[model samples]
Target: MTARALQRMIHVGCRELGLDADTRRDLQLVATGKASMAEMSEAELAKLLEALKARGFKPGFKPGVEPGAKGRRPAAPRPDLRYIHVLWGLLGKAGALKKPGRDGLNAFLRTRFEGKWGSVPIDIDALRDAGQINDVTRALKDMCRRAGVDT
Candidate 1:
């Protein structure tokens, strides 16, 4: 995580734990040997966050989890489409994909396998053939692996 993000999480943790400013500073000094967030390094901020978590501060949804409504879970993707999106999202998070949404993924599939598939649709979910679906999945997995994004 970036230094700024880690610092934000630390602050959030402090708030969730109802720590006063003085106590927060004390915790920071004890955990990282730094009293000011601005003066702390990313590693220090992470350490402070871990310490706060040990104190019972819970963070909300973490990075890379699929987004949904405020209190509702998102519908599950089809089995064939699941890994494709998961890999694509991982690549996106790693800053490897120019267009990270469904449209971009569909475009990528069309560009990469149009000739082999005879005709690739704009919506990848439209794919019906098992071979075509597997091809798209494999291609996406290859891209993710090449980009050093774990599937």
Candidate 2:
């Protein structure tokens, strides 16, 4: 990571850990022997991030993806459909899927559904048959399992 990105992550960590100004300064001093981020090198910033993570500061979002952008949750309303989305996300994260998100999943579903049922739903939510839904879920779960990704 760049120095700027590391510094940004450290600041985000401070907010996530709920550290007050004084406590943050103290921690910085302890970790890098410096109180200001500007004075610390990139390595020092990473060390501080590790300390913050050890103190239970989990990062909430990825660097490029903004908040409320496409994520694990798709627009499908049903719980079972959402579970399919979650499995798709796991495959995407594992780099098993060539494309990710609703469009990719939709395209894959179209091919599979049309081949078996001779027609495809307009979207995942349009899949009304319970058997079809179960088939898609089983397919996604099998893909995840094959990719070494937990469902």
Question: lDDT per model, in order?
Answer: 0.80, 0.85
Where model 1 places Cα greater than 4 Å from the true spot, the runs are 1-77
Question: Candidate 2 has what TM-score?
Answer: 0.51
**Candidate 2 residues 1-151, lDDT tens each?**
9999988888888876778889999999998899998998888999999989899777876545777787555467788887888888889999998888788989999987788989888778777788998999999988888889976
Top of the candidates by TM-score:
2
Model 2 stretches with alpha carbons more than 4 Å out: 1-74
lDDT at 147 for candidate 2? 88
TM-score of each: 0.49, 0.51
RMSD of 2: 11.2
Q: What lDDT tens digits, residue by residue, belong to model 1 across residues 38-139?
A: 998888888899899898776885433544536433533577876677878888899998999777888888788988878887776667788888887888
